[model samples]
Target: MRRLLLVSCSVAGLLALLPASGAVAVELPMRKAGLWEMKVLSGGSVPEMTMQQCTDATTDKDMSTAMAPMAKEICSKQDIQKTATGYVTDSVCGISGITVKSRAEITGDFNSAYTVKTSSQSEGGLAGAARDSNSTIEAKWVGACKADQKPGDIIMPGGMKMNVKDMEKMKALIPKK
Candidate 1:
């Protein structure tokens, strides 16, 4: 009975947050068009990561539009609000039986540099236990993309290069549990 009550409350909380969650994409300020280098500092579950991308306003918008469907499929709540200091985002995303609740604070001018700090809690899964983690992504604008690079091109570690538009194709390669 206690477990049922907790489950019921969780569902209710999620539903209440999305009274009008339709497919609306939140409007965000665009970063200056250029090459960007992003460093991710995450202490748990995975090691730190670094990547570079060539992006323009159109590329950013297209990436957001393309990811909407996947996000809606897994996330029940995703809210972004402008705060006095910066922007705050809260999301509840679940896959299989594991649910992850995360909150992120974003700051800095999108033109030159930006930072995103996130803290997340997970339960009802994660190897049959719960886990918590925090991460920060710091990004800075570089001069420009390489001559051979195009908009939406991302250079990952080990010199792996991929375009944002190709993400959907790679998604199919992931095994579903």
Candidate 2:
């Protein structure tokens, strides 16, 4: 159950990090090729987690492709606008039984470092309790991937490792439509 929660939390956060081209007017820049370390901090209920991902242009492009259709299917509204400081996004998405309405501010370019501050309200899930959450995710390019790591490889908390390209095999772990 802990691993499932970890995957759920990771996916939710990752959806916000990726560039949502299908719904947004402005195209967010892609991350530079390297290993990126991401820290997720949410106050209150959710726990803080950190993970690292190895990626290149092809991997990033594949992620965008995979996410575009899923977002279009599950998200009812997704709006993004650029500001002098960075980007702001508002989105409403329903995944499985939970409905999430969120707003986020993204700052800094993807080449070096980026931060995403997100506030969201979620309701109508198994817990049956409505909850409000505020989270900040900071990601930075640390350098090249380890010799053993390849593109799409992610090192999760507690040294759990997975590859994004292999997620399809774990579809059962993902929420259903």
Candidate 3:
């Protein structure tokens, strides 16, 4: 579950970097402020999972950079294209001794709902074993946040709660020197 959350968060952060359109370097269209549910169907070794997140514009923006700390160290060669219904992204990166090639397709009204389909292959890890996987993530606005939920909070399966913003803050606190 923790591994899944990490992958999902990283993917979410990557998706958030999409430009609003071909001519605009803006963020993706904003979704309604409230609870949003995401269902992830992952092929390969990863399990299927579902989770709910609390969000607003600010939180979404903050989460976009949540992976900044690792981005420079691991990611490179990102290519994105905007289409009528959504966008497609392809990237190459190195992580944990493996080189990964990834592609994702996103569609739907980003303001109210969106779905992302991602496929990736990792090479040079796991004792030289290559790994390939695909995941479909569907997210929908589920109205206002619950009383206990707050922006930046995501409730994982089994009721684990994570605040991506808080995690980013903690990452920031680590001194480079």
Candidate 4:
């Protein structure tokens, strides 16, 4: 369960870190409207996960709201610099008792497919364990959504379907000390 949570949180963090469209300092290019699938390959405490999401104009505009409750505990500052081929992101996020500093570079056209390379470190938390992880996400247009899937619907690797906002409701079900 812990591993699953970690995987879910990591995915959330990645999504939250993605540059949103608007007057923000760094805005990622908008993707094509369609069903997009992301494949996560992690080599740290986080397990691999695959998630498919339906993206339309509305959902694309409201993407910043898709994250776990734990993400609220993180205070982040990001700077994006455009490169010749892509954009580079430097971000510092404080999570739990650790401050994660990461640098990521994104390349390729945002409409069909793109790649992100990230490296991060932590100074405190769980015996000050410093974990380094990198992931590659390949997203492509998969046509229209199915009858059961709607915009903002996310399907997890194990066939779990959820709306990212529902995470808070699920967390409320857990007993706290």
Q: In order, what lDDT does every prediction score?
A: 0.69, 0.77, 0.70, 0.63
lDDT for predicted candidate 2 compared with the true structure: 0.77
Model 1 poorest 10 in a row by lDDT = 11-20
Clashes of each: 0, 0, 0, 0
**C-alpha TM-score for every candidate:** 0.79, 0.86, 0.80, 0.75
Per-residue lDDT value at 13 in model 2:
60
Two-way lDDT contest, 2 vs 4, winner = 2
Which scores higher on TM-score, 1 or 4? Answer: 1
lDDT of 4 by residue, 98-139 (tens): 667777777887577776666666567677766655655556
Task: For model 1, state the Cα shift of residue 164 in Å.
Answer: 0.9
Which parts of model 1 are misplaced by more than 4 Å? 1-26, 44-46, 124-126, 170-177
- The 10 consecutive residues of candidate 3 with the worst lDDT sum are 18-27
lDDT of 3: 0.70
Query: Per-residue lDDT of 1-177 in model 1, one digit per residue for the tens?
Result: 333323323332322222224575445577788899988676544556788999998987676666655566667888877778777778887766777787777788889998877777777853667766666778899888889999999898899999988866755653443
Best by TM-score: 2
lDDT accuracy of residue 97 in candidate 2: 89
| 1 or 2, greater by lDDT | 2
Which lDDT value does model 1 have at 120?
72
lDDT of 3 by residue, 119-157 (tens): 777677556777667778888998999999889899989
Alpha carbon lDDT of residue 123, candidate 2? 78
lDDT of 2 at 22: 55
